[model samples]
Target: SQKIEQNSEALNIQEGKTATLTCNYTNYSPAYLQWYRQDPGRGPVFLLLIRENEKEKRKERLKVTFDTTLKQSLFHITASQPADSATYLCALATFIQAGTALIFGKGTTLSVSS
Candidate 1:
């Protein structure tokens, strides 16, 4: 069955360390993969997107890796700070007849403290 899942436990880390998260999928081939960060009360904000043909994508302190064969993605955040703490979500972007949209995972929360 087509499915997407992320670690349910909240990730706690000390400020200045790197935070790593994982996203795994099965029974589906996505054309694109995207990562977003959501604040407590606000909606998710886009972080990065990777195409199926691309092995990885990066922007500043963020990095995303996609493996088509494994149907998985890994998201990373470097120089983690308290301000960077948030619920991170991974989505599979596919072109459905409905339109181009994102199917997001439940999300994984990261807490960074001194």
Candidate 2:
């Protein structure tokens, strides 16, 4: 079955360290890729978006890459802080005649500690 997969386990890291998260998909061609951060009790917030034709995207301390050939995307947080801890989700969007369809991974929880 076509699916998007992210690490189900939580990633633990110390403050000031870099945290890397992986998102892999099978049997899907997405036009745009997006990363989002969700807090414990809040909706997910948009982080970065990369086009299938683009290799990477960055903003502040966040970086994301899309490799259609490899069917994967990597999300990174540089100099991560405790406040940066959250559940990160990868979303794939494909434009359809109806409009746009979005598929999201289960998300990988990140825990940054002091």
Candidate 3:
């Protein structure tokens, strides 16, 4: 069976520091991996997408690295601030009877203190 896991608890940190989050998985080979940010009572916005062959991907203050061998992904937010506080989700595309849909983990809530 396929499984994904992210930090279930909220991460509290001071502003201007880098916040690191982890995602792990098992029994699945995803064609690509995606990260999204979700605000309260809103849908998640796509952040970065890393392909199976890509080692790393970046956007602004965010950086993501994928290790297919270990089946893990790391997400980082640099110079974080209170505005950066949100729940980050990791998702992978899965093949199903009806084509494919993204399989998302519970996500990790990051609380950046000002």
Compare candidates 1 and 3 on TM-score and give the better one: 3
For residues 1-114, write the lDDT of model 1, one tens digit per residue: 357899665999999999999999976778888899999999889889899999988899999999888888999999999999899999986556787666889899999998
Candidate 2 lDDT tens digits, 1-114:
458899666999999999999999888768888899999999999888899889998899999989999999999999999999999999987556787788789999999999
Which residues of candidate 3, in runs, are more than 4 Å off?
Answer: none
Best by TM-score: 3
Residue 84 of model 2, lDDT score: 95
lDDT of each: 0.88, 0.89, 0.92
Candidate 3 lDDT by residue in tens digits, 11-109: 989999999999898867787999999999999999999999999999999999999999999999999989999999999987788888889999999
User: Which window of ten consecutive residues has the lowest lDDT sum in model 1?
Assistant: 93-102
Q: Looking at model 3, which ten-residue stretch has the lowest summed lDDT?
A: 1-10
CA shift of 113, model 3, Å: 0.2
Candidate 3 clashing pairs, residues 3+ apart or interchain: none
